[model samples]
Target: MVRKIFRVLLTILGVVTGFFVADSIINSNYIMNLGYFNNMVAKVSLYVFATLSFGIILFLLSPIFYKGVSKLTDAVEKSIGRLSASEIIFGAIGGIIALLIAALFILPINKLLPPKLEILGTVLSIIINTVAVVVGVDISVKRKDDIMALFEGWKKGSSKDKKGKVKGVAKVLDTSVIIDGRIFDICQTGFIEGPLVIPSFVLDELRHISDSSDGLKRNRGRRGLDILNKIQKELTIEVQIWEGDFPQIAEVDSKLLKLAQKLNGKVITNDYNLNKVAEFQGVSVLNINELSNAIKPVVLPGEDMNLTVVKDGKESGQGVAYLDDGTMIVVEGGRKFIGENINVTVTSVLQTAAGRMIFAKQKEV
Candidate 1:
């Protein structure tokens, strides 16, 4: 229905153009001597013929015009959509200022041109104004980062990113790693560097969990809070409380990854799944589990040590013990020795995705 109405309007515009063209030709000095146009009826017929000719031509081309307009409109909408509000506002202001300057610049040039060349001058002026506005808008929007950086230096919170984000190389801590309480030990040993970041969102999540109805969650949350306090007060390393957060993002894990990315830092977490997700997303992550496993003492077969069997393993006639660092040691044929200290020989060592496990046998008396 809209297309039909547009087609009619287009045809009408073509008819108006044709009428003015006919009238211009008829009144011209060169055509005044033409006897054919001198006749009133012939001139009327010529006018009608030209109007209908152009109207019919434009009517046939209406669909093409409609499609072209549609494409142009879509392209314009997409271009505008990609611009933020500030960019759009500044671009509009720049374009307007450019057009004003262009108009001022062309007025004198137009006056210098002869009357016969006035149309050429007008075309040149249009081109100049258009190019000026385009250049102005392009410069205003594309250089926004550089302009924003000039102001960012004055503001505080970490440092200035090259592209206007928080520039940091500090370690960003997650709830799991914090609550595990091993990060403090690692920091104390000088293995982890200074300026550790604790994102506000992670703190809020810790607070929520600490106040949760579930006992385990409550304990874990409170422990994380306590560990954070300990790291801040007891550790010599610099610990920063990052007050920034992604309010639009709901999940705390997702927010942690985003904060890490924005800070240009590594995420320190113990969650296996979160580590996988962070790796998949191309964000750098330092898994405390992986680090712990990497630093665990290398145990070789045929090594004998005195250890206590704490519990029975899954397999028959097996007992499980742990080293000082929590790496599990599985003892074969030592299930009866549970709750007692025993001599064990390291038979084999297994490196699994979960962690390291050592298989040992009861040593000879």
Candidate 2:
């Protein structure tokens, strides 16, 4: 239906253009022969011919141009659909400002020039406008880090990026990593640097879990939100709430994988499943669990250590204890030693994709 309407419009436009073209060609000599109006009328005729000729050509090629523009628009929308609302808003503002500034410079030049030089002025103005729009978009994309840094400075007491180095990287946090909340500590330590991106969809999922009837899940979600708040308030990192998501992906793990790939950044996660999924997708991943496990004290088997058994383990007669870093230890035959600090000998180590576990027995002090 729309195509039919467009075809009808094209035919009307073509007929109007032909009339103008034929009229100008017929009246060309007559207009030139008239005294005092010769130069002015000649210019008018020239412009009219050019305009009509161009319009006619465009009408003839309308189908091709329409298809091309439709495709281009679709591609642009798809590409930009992943960006956050704030990002797109600011980018558009930047583009408009650039165009306005270009017009400020170019419009004056156009008005100051003589009538004969109008075409040249118009061409120059167009060049300026084109350059401005291109430069504006280019700056928006290329200087995303700088813009983020500026926002960071605004959030902080400072008004400048630290030494003008912009970190545009996005950090994708995982559930376990968020629950552990060492990322907040890591940010406070200033060891981890970059823009912190918490996908809004992830937050939504978190909220859902937090509101769940399950007490444990509710507690975990609340803890994660608290940690998120702490990071947002105290740290210099910009915590972005990314609403862009893949509806086709059922799980957050898969969504995280798709998002990391889209953003071209490392996934800051502790989930073994997510890490492996990200790796399979060729996306970089920063496993917080791996980092924690790596930084823990490397105690070999047969090494003796002092620990206080706090509670009973799942196995009968086994006492469980934790280190300062939260590494769990199962002390064999140490149930009697519960609530008392005692030395223990490391028995065996079990390593998994999640982390590490140690099985040990109580030793004489």
Candidate 3:
């Protein structure tokens, strides 16, 4: 139904264009003095012929035009999908201002050109309008933060709090942190303040994962989605799904880093590689693994603790055990005691960027 209506509109536009063309030709005097017939009959015949021919051509080409229109719409939708609401609003405002400013000179410029060059003047006006709109939108999008800050400052009279500290910063969640699912607990504890921003690209990645063919990946993806729903519904803090994205950056981690820089926010993740990359880029990161290690019960050297040896370690005669918090402990000479609970003395503790590891020797009676 819509396609039929669109085709009819296109045919009407074609007929209107043909009428204008016929009028221009008739007024030019070249085709009117053909001496073929009376002026009135010639003019009427030309108008009818042009209108029918153009309308039929457009009606036949409607499908092709429709395809082009569909492609253009998809392209526009995809481009706009990457932008946040604020960006679109500011971009529209900027474009309107640009067009208004261009209107001031459009008439004067058209009048200055020779009558023969009227088409050139019209084309120039179109070019100027197009350039102005493009420049306006680009400028607005690039300086959105400054624009927003101006409005915010105007509204509040000041953005700083009574303590002189800047207001809250968004906590950007990455893919790994979402899947790890400890963030829910952290948010529940109220340690993480401010709005938690889940980037749209991150959500896309999660959806892809959830739909993965592999069972493990699919489960992880679903779990992440569940965790996100839980955070948004169960937690008091705001969980926003940010639509801002960087098309140039292919990697999710790179995109997250760029977003952090843009928003002046921190990236929260449990991925060690991402943590290092973010640190190198001078973007603050909150690593769940690091946080877990920090809050684990501190064990000092010579401290005695009971651990159940569940498996053998890589080294000969070594047994591996785990603390309640998942910290690994390597027990020396305890390989024979697999599946047995034994007392061990903490020999030393090793802390790395990854996590903490403890070496222990079996305590002797």
Best by TM-score: 3
| Top lDDT model | 3
Consecutive 10-residue window with the lowest summed lDDT within model 2: 31-40
Error of 3 at 340 (Å): 4.8
Lowest lDDT sum, 10 consecutive residues, model 1, at 159-168
Write one digit per residue (lDDT tens) for candidate 2, span 1-365. Answer: 76666766776676677667755754677754764344667656665666677667767787886788779989999878766676677678778989999988987798899999988998898889888987887678556656765776687656555676466678887666787888998888877777778887788878988998999999999999999888888887767776556667888888887777677777898777777777787989888778888889987999999999999988899999998988899999878889999899998999877678999997755
RMSD of 3: 4.3
TM-score winner between candidates 2 and 3: 3
Clashing residue pairs in all predictions, respectively, total 0, 0, 0
Instruction: Look at candidate 1 and tell me the lDDT of residue 247.
Output: 50
**Candidate 1 vs. true structure, TM-score:** 0.53
Encode model 3's per-residue lDDT on 63-120: one tens digit a residue: 9999899899999999988788989998999999989989888989998899999999
Q: Give the Cα lDDT of each candidate.
A: 0.86, 0.79, 0.89
Ranking by TM-score: 3, 1, 2
| Candidates ranked, most accurate by lDDT first | 3, 1, 2
User: After superposition, which runs of candidate 2 have C-alpha atoms over 4 Å from their true positions?
Assistant: 1-168, 210-219, 247-250, 309-320, 332-341, 361-365
Candidate 1 clash pair list: none
Give a tens-digit lDDT track for model 1, residues 44-118.
Answer: 998998899889999999999999998999999997865667788778878988899899889999999999998
TM-scores for every predicted model: 0.53, 0.52, 0.77
